[model samples]
Target: MQKIIFYVVVLLCLVVTKIQAQETFEQRAKVIAENIENITREEKKILKDKVDVINTQLENKSITREEADKMKIEAATFHAKRIEERVAFEESRLNTLIKEKVDGKIQEASADSVTSKRVSIIEVRYRKGNGNGKRKEVIEKRTTSQLVLAGGVNNLVTGGAVANSKFRYWGSHFYEFGLTFNTRIMKNNNLLHAKYGMSLVYNNLRAVDNQYFVKNNDQTELVTSSTWLSESRLRNIQLIFPAHLEFDFTPKKVNEKGETRFRTHRSGRIGIGGYIGANLQTRQFLEYQRDGFEVEEKQKSNFNTNGFVYGLSAYVGYRSTSLYLKYDLNPLFKNNSADQNNISLGLRFDLN
Candidate 1:
């Protein structure tokens, strides 16, 4: 009686296994069919979108009617070919599933769960394309960054006059380097931007007529050096934060989705702003001949230079290069017979 019961149980287990296999095969087949249908529908939708964009271009007079017609025809052909290839790929997958079922290799699972996932992935990829089998270009970014570099002549205007300057025009120089961030001011417009960043500024001045900066009690003055000198330079190092309101004149463009986008640095731009910072260090370098020997002296001191500094700056140019100007709003030194303000004019480059 026990042997007869075992035979009956074995027969029932085989029947259940066969039924599950059949169900799995049918479910997988249905998933593939649904995927095929989805591919066709998605391609059609994408093609319609492309046509809409082309029509928009035609209405805007951006493209001639002949060009628009040609574009539409190309879009249709491309989508049709995509549909054919994709359907063939799905059919091949279905055939593979059928063969697996015949070989008793397909496992029992819910195929509907995978169907949506696969279809969604394909939809994302198709949407990224521009109906020409190529992905669309990225249109815009709300914020961008640049590496700022500037160098040029440096001088100080004494008594608000350049003619009374004590520094040599060709000998003195300034250099600046920093990283800057530029953000669009409006949501749908790229005509204006706010640019802000930090910078390290090195301002050097070479006094004229063999003169060097001297600290006289509570005052700073330029006195004649006793020794014949080849170099007499006073340098001030500063760390400053700069902010600007920039106006960009780059033309806007329309994307495949008929959305207007702005691209910067493609045309001329103007930036007007200011900077404020504290003096980091001040030093005077002297190179001369004394006692029939080459002598070099580096004097480190405050020399009554201003501790806090603020300046007005502006730039205007095409693309990445611009003519830059900066002028200090405060005196160069705290205690002095005549007030002298630092000024700079040079070429500035902003590399994105």
Candidate 2:
């Protein structure tokens, strides 16, 4: 009778331990599920934020609706894939824990035939895709559009005897700014692209000598100023439309659509092309110290300069930063006694 009582006590203890182990497994599995869900929720928020940006871009006309939609689709697909992978990992972990618990229960109750059977139960119900289709698919056409702003420095250089003359470039005074659209030309070949836009270009030349430009019929003569001048600057503003065929050498990144997008101009790029536009305004700016006060003077005139201008422009560099050079095929002044062409070199920024 005592032996039977001892076996009864042992059996009762094993049953209690198995019940406690099952409860612990359930709690752990619940915690794991919650953690996985939290991480997925954070990732979804990030992807949604990107979609919001794309929508804003569309509303602003910075990007086309098709482009914005494409971006949204890509973001959704990417987010879904990430969630699936993470859930799969967590599910595997939970399965291992449950399996260990069951195996332990079986071992502890091995003396009884009723409680020693293996328990195998796996529930897998996962939602897939962006809910747009039965099978996952990515967009085939990949395109991007954005508003670009660029600004850089400018200077002038000449050829022949004038090149030998002492000339000064006002480093701080010369610059150009443009609002443009940089787009890929071919869908597959992202390396080739076209950039076209409107720019407000300001070119300032500071002569070393106390000289000013004088227009005589068709002649633009560089003559000395009658009054002593503290500063003499020639300011020319051109409303230009520039176009370039660019080659991007930087590594490309594959998007969700399996299409490649060129790295930014800062990454490495080269552009070769030209521009044709009209000179909007030209004036001579003079600053002097009269008595003890500073005096400023501006003389607005054509100075026999051409109304229309065309130039050859090229740039090479990495990322959005580049070295820019431009040369006018025609003279700055039409049919002048002295033939002085306009050539400028500067740095450029391309918002890609």
lDDT to native, each model: 0.73, 0.60
Worst 10 residues of 1 by lDDT: 117-126
lDDT value for model 1: 0.73
For candidate 2, lDDT tens digit of each residue in 222-252?
7887778887778777767788898876556
lDDT of 1 by residue, 185-261 (tens): 98777789899987767899999899998899989988998888899999988778899999989778776877676
What TM-score would you give candidate 1 relative to the actual structure?
Answer: 0.61
Candidate 2, number of clashes: 6
lDDT of 1 at 165: 77
Worst 10 residues of 2 by lDDT: 117-126
Which ranges of candidate 2 are over 4 A from the true structure? 1-162, 170-173, 255-266, 291-293
Q: Residue 84 lDDT in model 1?
A: 53
The estimated TM-scores of all candidates read 0.61, 0.55
